[model samples]
Target: MEPVPLAVGLAALLGLSSAVLEVHVGQTSVVSIKGQQAILPLWYTSYSNSRPFVSCLLERRDPTKHLQVLTYIDGKSKVDEKYFKHRVGFLYPMPSPNVSIAINNTQEDDSGQYMCTVNLGDESSTDGRNIGLVNLTVLVPPSSPTCKIQGTPHVGGNVTMSCKSLSGKPSPMYHWRRTGPSFQVFFAPVQDLSKGTLTLTNLTTDMSGTYICNASNSAGYSNCTITLEVTPAFNAAVVAGAVVGALIGLGLILLFALQMFVYRRKKKDVQEEMANEIKEDAVAPKTLSWAKSPGSDVVSKNGTLSSMNTAQDHKLYPSKPPSDTASVTTATGSMVAYKPPYNNPRGGTLTPTPSLSSQSLPLYFPPTVNGIHCHHANVPVHRNAQHRTNGAQPQAPRQEHTLPPGLTSSTLTRMGAVPVMVPAQSQAGSLV
Candidate 1:
């Protein structure tokens, strides 16, 4: 037969697509580092009742070498000691029916095509067996990338940037960026982009800063940065004016901040002073007044006022109320109206008349209207009692102050009592 392509010839000789037996291996190459184990994945199926034989081989085109690495037949291994030694073996041995193998401590020289074959006794020959193939390649990380600018870096100028990394398996991807304050990264303006080059057109003053290039792959990544300074000619007078204006603005801001600070401080101090005044008012003792009415704001003398004890010896007679009669009507058939002493022309002041007793105490009447008194006097206890029995000093006759004919005692009590002095003889004493 005419010689066939290696792949087609191998498939035809091994009958890999036969219905009686099937073999499988990696459709793509397997990658591994030097000094590391690599698996040449394989599997097979045989319709024979008895376990079939299996073998694995390596083919290298560059060195023109073909080597059988693994074999199993009749419950025993017949390995190639010259090529594999202890470096190759079936991952799953016979009786279990697995055919994959492991290549131990692989090297650059081990990179080649791997083949697996399965044979059924009496039905399959060595040249007509099932087959599979796997290929492997090792990889290495790339070196640091070199970044550079190819044109003058100035305002409104065009520039070209390039990035490259050396010695990496597979290749590396390139990315161009600018590094800003706080380590922020931004993409450069792109006019044209290619494998390892970037073109920036119509550069502005804002584009002047640090630029970076990064290259990455499945193996590793590398980066580099370049400082770009764009110097644009400017008028000296314009620059000076801008600097002066900025300085003035800064000074104004500082002055305004100082004024606000002072205002806030003063406001806080004033609040503190007001708080202290309120606290002092709350803690100070209040002055007491005997004449002060409840809920009234009027100021009065501080001494205690006296009260009368009607149960002792005196009899209180209430005059007719304002609604009962136009004026007070007395037992003597006289009508007298009572009014407040505060509005009196006499200023409610009392002047002593003739002495009522040896004590020489003055008796005063509050403002009266038409002979009707606003207050009742305290009757002396010595008066109106039985004459002194068994040598008691002769008792004084009680003076009578009669009330109107229709007035009741209950009405007198509700009208309120006037403060008064009592006689020295009474044991009940004065009320206060």
Candidate 2:
């Protein structure tokens, strides 16, 4: 039992001595810039009197496994040419307690946990205590940020000022401040530090000026500037009123044009109606005038002097007889014989008989049996003796008269003037 207790005590002492020879790391974390060098520190204390064979290795710790970065064995050093190549090497010669390694030309992909393991000759301690850990971070400086203004910079409107960096390690923080004479450090505007934005509410003209944004991280800082200008608000009411007034004026003009069009159309219609009435009146048939007595003068509606022959006058008034003494009577009436005086060779007028003189005669006579149209007031009455006989009356001779230009027989009849057959001899100074 005493021997068993001594063996256990000795085993515990050996484990303590081995633990004292384990590797120790300095600075659990390290930060460096890209394209620079990084150092993973490892050291150990010697417990034995004589020199011991030291073998060490540096590995990168991954989520799945550990990757060999560098190795030292038999006083020789070798790096994983597949990954680290010549960029990774031991900082000091082997066979010493210091087993630190340097990684030159570090990149972003080199940022990860690194471990250093040490082993003594023929003493491989699998207890996992002879190892050192270091976390490396390759930092990238903040780039030059871009400043921009968003939203309309009008009075009483909300606006946003933004700052952006194309690349930065550990994400840069943003700070916004106004520059120029209006700047005040304590009066910094409200901003989102993570998103690099500054928000302004209810903007005013006084806020117009140069603004600057600073993006900073542990590595370095970059700044950008922008100018803000707040303009006066637009007057929408005035524009609307002007537009409405223009529309109203245009409408009035159109309405006036429409009224003018309608008035012209109505005026044209009235003129056409009046013209049609005049045309109807002109085309209407003229009525023949009725004489009250044979001695009465016939006048047309147009006030033209007109006379009709006994045949036409009797047809209109069958009970009346013509007043002319030379006119032949019907079987129911008595005829008054007329004897014309001889015409004077010097064109002197002959006295008419009382019975013929009492009758009103037409101003002009139709053509006589000699085919001569004569005026009662100008021509002398001429009688031929051969036209008369005792109790053997000759019929009156008919004559045709050529009407004046533009006058037809129907037009003359409408005017109450008709040609009639008359005796060649008439009462002296009496119209035939």
Candidate 3:
């Protein structure tokens, strides 16, 4: 090969120097027990006492004042007389490149950040690249964590809980567990674990129990417990049921009252109707008949004989009457003149008139006594109209009769429709 170019040769030399100017691989944080020897190992990749001399400086992390612990160079070392007189020194001399240091009889104050820095010289390219920190933490077991819950524990509520281990060599990690019939551990999420707190979402009855918080570090573990009691909330189903039951009960009571009111009103109406019918009968003309005709079709010109013959056939009455006016039908469907004996003015008597062809007929009463106005077989009665008779009238101007208060002709007809037992005296009186 031809002679190597000078510029390319210089570039290769600089790359080789950069590769070898790094800190050693084994140098890392140091941990030890109090009152024991602690070692802070540090080394460089390349060793030389030539142009840029090698040196190592140890520093402690102090903000107000820079605390320089030791300085080692040229195979010897110097330490701060006040803090590290006999406690700190180099482990090996120059030419060997073991820039490691040690602290004999390490105290509690030695547990802090210790930085080891190596320098070739002011003009060296790797000035800050060879620096590292040996974090020194003295051994101490974890203290018992003080566990506490922060909020009301009820169903559907969220609560926060905390655990703190006050003393440990390194910061302790915390885990929560529940103690009951059997042990139940809680695996908190990553977010909760970072803050050493447990957050329970949508709490339930099952979560109420003795809770334990375990704290651990490199030295040992410790735990503490707190009892948790969750209160119950109102049940929606029970409240809704009570409201519905009350409404149903009220409805039933109202319905019962309405039925009772109707029954009492109907009973009072019936009693009043019977009394009025008795009074009417007491003042009625003795010539009036309760008689059936010869064949339900024929009647005598003498009303007395027909009344006597029909006294035994008292089954013509109905239990209930129609709401509309009563009507009488003849063979030709004609409405006939029906005159009540009370209206005759002849002391309730009738004159003997010529008999007609036999046909079945009902005894008709006039409209005067109770609003019992008659309607034709084909016509309807208007309640709002003043009632009038349809038959031929006498020469005298007649006087109209008014019904008793609250009494209508339909009501009177309904009362008359009810079956009544005629005593023996009434039969004898009728015969006489």
Candidate 4:
């Protein structure tokens, strides 16, 4: 009895007339367990690209009519029961020219040995030296790792996470990897690297994830995926403190500006008050002082022409405005106008009669060089300032004159007031 071939898989050739699946096929092939259904891929043993492939027709070699076509696999032989039982196609013409084995409806269990042999026939003659071997050990991901999580301590603190509940023999190789990405692995047990713990010294948002612990021994590999779920340590308390501090600083700045404004306002008010006082003092009216004079400039003895001086500087002086009293309505009316005897002509000056023009106060003062000959003293000094008018000082009133010893005796009677003559003894006493 000849031995059956250890492999059964697809075979292809560029141009071949006869039906013979004789080339070394790849570990993964296009095979279907149920007609027109699905396909399965095997990852391990691969075909050599250097050789050409050929697929043999099954009905040409089936010695018994009971023999049916079936396929097989290599590493995943434990999952091969479905591929043996499912019907594929019937053999019609012996040694048919082209027989295409279309793949359909495949599952993980359809991964192993299949055959095209006669039922109750010699098993040795059914398979040949060019065996059909498919390496179909499929990958099965382990359960999700169950573990607790904690937040990162501080900004610069380190963090770590562990993977648990992995099965198999040889104390499986632990590879710390993360899913949702293909990263350069930091640890793989085949490379004699680190174990389950993944440590990050300075933790940040980039360090969090669903970590894939690739645990593998000889019993085939699996992945225990755990999520680290790292959270940031920054909080609201620190930000609030900064805002409060800024507000306090702004308040201090506003208070300082207000104080400066108040100080300037007060200083300007004081300056304005001082300026007003200076202006009042400058325009106040003052008395005029004159020296003793010769001739008409000398004083006269008339108690009526008082030389008054005010005791106060700010005393009020009201003067009659131009429109206060009536004026001469006509020159003819002036001849009958009311007049005062006090507005008479000066002493030593005889009036023939009052003229129409010279009504009162005749010879108010004659224009002279630097002097006036007054036969009377004018207004008295040492009186209240109410007598002053506008800013003008009051002129002294006329006085009655007394004749000198040498003048004629009638001169004394003509003058209404007397001259203030001091006795020679009194003058001598003043000089002493």
Kindly list the per-residue Cα lDDT of model 4 for residues 1-432, writing each as its tens digit: 011122323222433222333323333344332223423211111233222222222222234532223332221111123343443332222222112233333443434443322111111122553444333322223334433334453455666655544533235555676664335466532233234566656766665656666655544555656665445555434666789999999999999999999999999999999999898779765433321222113232221122221112102221111221223222233323333222223323322111122221211222233465332322223232355432224444323343334545334223322222111111122100
What digit string (tens of lDDT, one per residue) describes model 2 on residues 1-432?
133234345656777653344556767898888789998776654454333343433344555545677777766777777768889977776566666778999887788887777767535555676777888899987899999888988889998889999988989988888887488432345788888889899988898888899999987899999989888777445666889999999999999999999999999999999999888889655443443423224322222222333333322221211233333221223333323432445454222212222233333333344564332222223333345322322323333333345656554334333234222234453234
TM-score to native of every candidate shown: 0.37, 0.47, 0.33, 0.23
Candidate 1 off by > 4 Å: 1-22, 26-38, 47-55, 60-89, 93-96, 103-112, 119-127, 137-142, 182-194, 217-220, 232-432
Taking every candidate in turn, the Cα RMSD to the unseen true structure, in Å, is 20.0, 16.8, 22.4, 20.9
Off by over 4 Å in 2: 1-20, 47-66, 122-126, 185-189, 234-432
Please give the lDDT score at residue 135 for candidate 4. Answer: 32
lDDT of each: 0.56, 0.61, 0.56, 0.36
Query: Quick one: ranking by lDDT, best first?
Result: 2, 1, 3, 4
Say which prediction, candidate 2 or candidate 3, comes out ahead on lDDT: 2
Instruction: Give model 2's TM-score versus the native structure.
Output: 0.47
Error of 3 at 91 (Å): 3.7
Q: Which ten residues in a row have the lowest lDDT in candidate 2?
A: 313-322
